[model samples]
Target: MKLSEVISIVDGALITANADLDMDISSACGADLMSDVLTHARSGAVLLTGLTNPQVVRTAEMAEIVAIVFVRGKRPPLETILLAEEKGIPLVTTKSTMFKACGCLFQAGMNSCDV
Candidate 1:
């Protein structure tokens, strides 16, 4: 699925203005634990999480995630956003809980990175 479609699926707002909205994301991983994300998330996957810190951005970068969706209407700090922007990762915020957001994306045909 495209990043734009993911945004629509989760009813999220894209906070990364300069990032590519048309990026193709084949899978997603929803986790708040950076360690779990690092262990299981696939490259080019979208990371859905409630944690909004520089560490999350760093983890996404290290994992080569395509984008990030901050669940429960949570927004990252300016420093984190700046880091994401510098890394060229799209950032989104949704009012849905982590489970709901993941479900919506799954219903829209995006698979989980559960290999």
Candidate 2:
């Protein structure tokens, strides 16, 4: 699915400046643990997480995640946002819980990252 479509499906708002709105998101991974993200998330997947730390951005960079959706309306701090901007990773926030957001994306035909 396209980034724009994923955002729409999850009712997310983009918070980063350098996003490719049309970028293709090959899969989704919902996890709060950075270790799980690094271990299970596939490249080009959009990470749906509740973490608002700068470390989340760093992990996304290392894992080659296309974007991050902060669940439960959680927004990252300025430092985290800046790091994501620096890495060219888009950041989004949604009012849905992690489970709900993941479910919405799954229902919309977005595949989950293979475990």
Candidate 3:
């Protein structure tokens, strides 16, 4: 699915400038634990999480995640945003809970990375 489609599916707002909204995301993984993300996430996947810290961006970078969706209306700090921008990762935010955000994406034909 495209990043634009994911944003529409979860009713999210893109917070990053110069993001390629047309980028295709092949999989997704929702986790608050950076360890779990590193363990299970796939390259070019979208990470949905409630954690809003620089570590999240760093973990996404290491895991090759294409984008991040901060759930429950959470917003990352400026430092985190800057890091993500530098890494060329798109950042989105939604009011949905982690489960709902994941479900929304899944229902829209986005498979879990583990699948």
Predicted candidate 3, C-alpha RMSD: 0.8
Can you write out model 3's per-residue Cα lDDT over 4-88, one digit (the tens) per residue? 9999999999998999989999999999999999998999999999999999999999999999999999988999999999999
Task: Encode model 1's per-residue lDDT on 11-108: one tens digit a residue.
Answer: 99999769787889989999999999999999999999999999999999999898999999998999989999999998999999999999999998
Candidate 2 lDDT over residue span 26-48, tens digit each: 99999999999999999999999
Candidates arranged by TM-score, highest first: 1, 2, 3
Query: Which residues of candidate 1, in runs, are more than 4 Å off?
Result: none
Q: What C-alpha lDDT does candidate 3 achieve relative to the native structure? A: 0.94
**Model 2 lDDT, full chain set:** 0.95
Candidate 3, poorest ten consecutive residues by summed lDDT = 106-115
Residue range with the least summed lDDT across 10 consecutive positions in model 2: 12-21
